[model samples]
Target chain A: MTRLELLAPMTGRVVPMEEVPDPVFSEKMLGDGLAIEPSEGLAVAPMAGSLVVFHSAGHAFAIEGPESVSVLVHLGLETVSLKGAGFERLAEVGDTVAAGQPIVKMDLAAIAAAGLRSISPIVLPQLDEGWRISKTNAATVQAGRDVLITIER
Target chain B: MQVKAQAYLEALGGPANIKDIEGCITRLRMTLIDPSKIDVRKLQAAGMVGRPMIIGKGVQVVVGTYAELIGAEINKILKQK
Candidate 1:
């Protein structure tokens, strides 16, 4: 079995997805994953892979993950409407990114003042069957730290 | 604001073009069939906070706090049509 690591994209307390206010995320409609009560606004790649979906809106970006899993990193609630106003894209679409590499820098204060929640969800929308996903319970994690999600294949 | 949201969806290729709808705090994340059908200028004129993008066969629109509501509205509009 191969073990893959999903790194922490930002420095934050890892919360169960249920802690996320939105049903879509909290309920795991998007897929099984954890939510981060972000202390910083910098979003990074959780695994080294191609940048498959980089929304210009800056609210979200998805990295094609290792082992064919796709990871969607959504920053804040409705922060997309800010239109990149407070987000600085460090990487472009189709670019290859490494785990924990800085991909987007966000203005946390601007996002909060705009009345948006900064809870970021790191989701595996296309999690494959037979792959086991495990997470660390309610802990503060640093960006680029190894394996927030330990995947057993 | 809801009316504007509807209009914005219409501008972005309508509900029929939408394949899947989900939302984050401030954006209505959707997978659409065609990205070319979107009218970015109209959405901008309507005071949309951000430009829509075609990401991995999906369209993400920044609709602020009303994102979830708009996602529901898109479904309703799709059902109606």
Candidate 2:
């Protein structure tokens, strides 16, 4: 059965990427993805797949895994507008990025000194139309870590 | 609704400097400086439109496809800056 899978978008602790509910305020929050600063190291493809979307700034990407999982990487929220000013594009659209391949290298100091965080967001684009995503306990994830919810299609 | 929306935008540092906004399935992604200062409730209460969800110890706001629209609004706002 083709199942859904997640791969590490960055090289860092594969902590369970989850949403935090501020019970006091009664709200929920999204994980910043693998929280690692730019250039602490390079973010790699968790798995080899087709590059579905690549932002112009070269900070984020999406991939449809071999198992039919869609993943998104928001490198730095507003950084996209930087227009590749502080980031270097390591891969091009339609290019097959290999797992653990070097996609882009960032200048962490410049980003932080400029008051930006290196924490990026890697997400499963959708919950397959007719299916519910099943998951195990959230674990610390590193680049290439298998931390994903399988869509039972 | 107008008043509530303003309150949230203010908490998010107002409609100023907001260059873009977008989200994944569970987040109302905001791109701004010192993201640490975001008052999600203020933004939510201000009627930005979206539900806040808690997944994996993080906060997310639902903006739907309008997320891109909000982002464009932000971009337009940035042009003046």
Candidate 3:
């Protein structure tokens, strides 16, 4: 069995994915995961892997690690409509990233000013029947240092 | 298993119902002419990851990382017709 630990992509209060306002995330439509009401604007890589999917809008990106495990970090709810206005891409797709390396820098104030929720969802978009996932119990987590999600397969 | 774009288009009420469609990382965001015509069961059968969501004339199908490819495929089919 392979075990993968996903670090918190940003410092924030960790909440269950169900609390995200958007049904796409709260309903766990994409996959089971957690959300964070970010207290900072910087998002980091959740694991050591090659950056695979980085949205042009800079609202989301995914990293593929050992065992083909992928973790997606979405900056905020409906931020995609912003079309990269308040987001800055720090890392490009295909770049090898380590857990905690900065990926995108978001302007939280601007996002909120645009009337969008800044609660970010960290999801495992791909999972198999043999995989098991565990979420962190901590109310608040530090980026790159705290284990946010654990996956085993 | 990757879902065939043709299957997704059919599940979404075919190319005629789709007014606009785009990929947003993990989901296909679409504006349909008749949102009610979307078949959730058909979408599931087409390998959708979770329940498809409808908000007014807009429908979102969570197709994970392959959303871009699927959206492009659907668009190609729409252009052909």
Q: Which candidate is the best by TM-score?
A: 3
Model 1, range A22-121, lDDT digits (tens) per residue?
6667767657889888898888899999987776667778888667877888888767678778899999989999888999988889988898888988
lDDT of 2 by residue, B1-81 (tens): 234334445666666634455433223455555455567777666544444443332444554222433444444554556
What is the lDDT of every predicted structure here? Answer: 0.77, 0.52, 0.88
User: iRMS of each prediction in angstroms?
Assistant: 9.8, 6.6, 1.7
DockQ of 2: 0.08
* Residue A69 CA displacement from its true place in model 2, Å: 2.8
Q: Runs in model 1 with CA error above 4 Å?
A: B1-81
Across B1-81, the per-residue lDDT of candidate 3 in tens digits comes to: 224888898998987899999888778999999988989899888878777777899888888776766787788878889
Please tell me which model should have the higher TM-score, number 1 or number 2.
1
Clashing pairs in 3: none
Top candidate (DockQ) = 3
Candidate 3 stretches greater than 4 Å from native: B1-3
Candidate 2 chain A, which ten residues in sequence have the lowest lDDT sum? A19-28
Where is model 3 chain B poorest over a 10-residue stretch in terms of lDDT?
B1-10
Residues A6-65 of candidate 2: C-alpha lDDT, one tens digit per residue? 555665543334421222111212212233323354666756787766655666666666
TM-score of chain A of 2: 0.70
Computed on C-alphas against the true complex, the DockQ of each candidate is: 0.06, 0.08, 0.64
> How close is chain B to the truth by TM-score, in each candidate?
0.81, 0.50, 0.91
lDDT of 2 at A60: 67
